[model samples]
Target: MNYFLMLSNSHADGVLSWYQTLRLEGRMCDVVLEAEGVKFPAHRTLLACSSDYFWSMFQDYTLESGAHTISLPALSSKGLEQILDFIYTSWIALSPSTLEVTLQAACYLQVTPAVDLCIEYISESIALDNCCFFANIAAHYGLSKAFTVSNSFIARSMCRILVAEQYKAELLELNLDSLQEVLAAEEMPGVKEMALLQLALDWLEYNPQSALQSNALLCRIRYSLVPPDELSRLSAIEPALCTPFIHSVVHKALNYHLQGPLQPLLQSVHTSLRTTNSKILLVGGGPEADRPQNQILAYEPRTRKFRPLSTTLPTKLQHQGVCVVGHFLFVLGGEVVKVDEESEKSAVMTVTDQVWRYDPRFDQWEEMEPLLQKRAQFTCCVVEGVIFAIGGRGQRGEPALSSVEKYTMNAGCWRSGVSLPHPVHGQACATEGTGIYISGGIYGNSPDSSKDVLFLHAFEGDAWQRRASMSIARFGHQMATVRGRIYAFLGMYEPFCDIEYYNPEQDLWTHLKPLLNDRFCYGLMATGGRRVLVFGGRKWQEGQEVCTTNVLEYDTEYDAWREVCKLPGPLCGTQCAIMTIQDPPET
Candidate 1:
């Protein structure tokens, strides 16, 4: 009986084999596809399931009745043959010679899976020689990721591309928007600004009519980021840029030249996008559940949106300390509570030293040496390329800890550092110059034991010393640094609208403008040099408090706050940190 059952199951697994056989033999085909006046046999049900265009055609009974065969007018014969083979076999051949045509056919049929496969192929097949060819196809099919990936290849091989006679000859046909986007990218980190100017001039020489007509494209160039010397060279080459009206822009850029924090001259939409856009990462703090399934979330500043990263922490974590060391993002010690099987409810589980490091450049993660002591509700900071994890209680949340540990990238080990002056947790920490600053934390055993005392630890001194306290007590608050100044945010206590910072120079804490809403325990990150973004947190209203997805962005230079974007759900008491990932590798 078992032998017969095995035979039946094996046959069931190969049930689709009949479709492949029929497609290969051109026998019992219910539909015919005509491309370039040639016919190919296909099974209607298989084609309908594989392609939206075919599905819609089959859905209309009147259309099916009128036509026994359909003409794929936009598809080449080879492309149509490949599509039919994919519908039956779940695979199709792709190569440089046929990749573009195959992708075009798949997109026209709205076959997302095949199109995705084609995109993956394009991403893998990118090289300096064919990057523009791939980019042209990507733009035609609205494949933004493909364009971005290929552009990096083009950017890295830029010197070669600039000199390549083939690319120069084809520059005239390059899409205008694609050229603008590639040139506008602030991603050109160390490639001297002069090279970008040269590329722009090269394009202008080939297409002067468009250059003379469109200043909007010209505005996309990051003129402010360039040095005055480079601009001088540019002016010598392009006289239109130095004309009286445009020369004023050059003067503004050269004078300010993005030298100081107050250098706010360049407000062009292009520069704003290039400079301000970065990804803010969020971890844990999902729906409260028995099992505690938590994943990492990323917020793209360019899109002003939230998206979850593909990888998650080793286990569900809450109140974990996160810090960045160079290209690596480290998730330090945190607490995880799961329901006991006997009680069937949440229970005190464990304080974890489980450490996970993520490298966003490669979208990869690995386990790092765990912390010396398990902790949560702690504050972490990176000073002089070393990570310091300080003061937080163990599981069950009793007597607070004064322990501090340092994680060094070179050593890849955690060693004890000078502990905090006293037991405290839920403090906010940031590094300004060479010192690490801690402000506002809970001193007692519980969350309610909040305090406003502040402290500073200089790696030079290797000691923690008491500093001036905040005007109000806060616990579970956040801190962010902008232009060497530390900004402390309100925690879960009263005066939730106020934000204050300690002045290392004056040794005093001062309040900035109060927030638009009272918030506590939201994910906070500083980006774009002048802006601090706060994510979802709890909100108070009608004498009741509940979790909220509200987000507010504050500008330090302007001393102004405005709504940006919201998280996917309400979150509170969650830990957050900001780190910049290096751009794409030299292709």
Candidate 2:
């Protein structure tokens, strides 16, 4: 019986002849068997087989049955000859059109050497005209060298052909240097020079330092394209690049090109900003009031001011789980109280599990489902639109909770996550890029706080790791990141004048000037540009705690603090959220 199979041209690269001779001599009979009519079966035992037979057999096998089958496609005589040649000699050369199909077949057959040779040939043959399509395929298959070469070729050619006047700005999206090289090569006598200048100016506006080192190169090209007078006129372009150039003029800037650290604390803040920068809705209590009067305050960073936000809560609340996502602020469980008029009696306040959302657009609040477990003194942060409620002491005299629950913004549902490594209350939680940093809170049974900084990285991924400890212990302290540095503000502990800064990159902490007023549990918000605003918190004096309504602002640039605005009323346990907006002050 004779068996015939179709082969791809790519398999014609010369290993098949030896295998064919062995099969014909019946030396490989144990591994090579005859199937009915024009097809030979590979005896599952033969380690080596002709590429053509392998490709055909590969396409023919069904993984479902876990067995090999002889299946061949109908082919012209020429195609059949190529198949036989590859089966006998292990290699076949063919046209580009035929090569593409064979390449796919070779890959399917697990023929490594043949597939690689075809890819190399394609890469060498790629040109500007066919690069786009070829590059797409190369990128999809993770053929790095092929993709880069094809893209570079197209970019280089585009630069050479398109004149300054005819240059397509969309081409800038390709490769910057290649585009610049192309522009440099073209000789434009008229409006072409002006167009090139305009394109360069726009690029410099968006990214100044990107091409900083290449300024001399750009200047030389400019001199060639335009007269000195015209080049000088283009100097006053917006989004000035002159400053950066001057800053690096003295010395060549270090080209370390180092990537920023994947800090958990830093990632948390970035994640929050990307998810939403809507109106910050603050929830807290009024001074000395039972049935804490919950109020929402909104601040626009652009204007650098605050405005009261309207809410629809049936009663006031304080010490609530507050988190902002998109345009909505989710305010969870808090405490409130009732007063008796007939007997002038006061009672222990009642805790609530009510949840409310504040919409900035309408300045309105809507009621939502309450928490399954009521918590106060809890901290909440949003990660990937999911609000995580962490360690907060429950109702009065209730045990502190290590239970971590996550509220999904998309599903409008709450689910439990990996509990905290340690339960602590009055902790300051800050999110940087993708990680959450939970710093200094009351950890053990004792009220004595911890200086240990607990770092939870990629909290959504169930990975938690601790980092270096803080220089000082703090609870009810506020933490904010400005200029890539973390500032841990005043909080309760032995040191009454506690204020510290943490540098995650260095894994070191430095002490900053203490707050003008020593206080703990203040509403801290980073606002305007680089200002850290401290609202209200309790002040401890002579073993007594007093709530203060003073508002102080810390300038990160100057590393100094100055009192800004005072609260309308004395407040404690109030939420303060700040959002940045656009619009510069009138000069």
Alpha-carbon TM-score of each model against the true structure? 0.53, 0.49
Best of the candidates, lDDT: 1
lDDT against the true structure, each candidate: 0.71, 0.57
TM-score of 1: 0.53
Q: Considering only N, C-alpha and C atoms within 3 Å, which residue pairs clash in candidate 1?
A: none
Worst 10 residues of 2 by lDDT: 255-264
Q: Which stretches of candidate 1 lie over 4 Å from their true place?
A: 1-277, 288-293, 340-347, 444-457, 580-587
Tens digits of lDDT, candidate 1, 216-244: 45555666546568787777778657656
Q: Write the per-residue lDDT of candidate 2 for residues 52-78, one digit (tens) a residue.
A: 444344343535123444334433334
Give one clash count per candidate, in the order shown: 0, 32
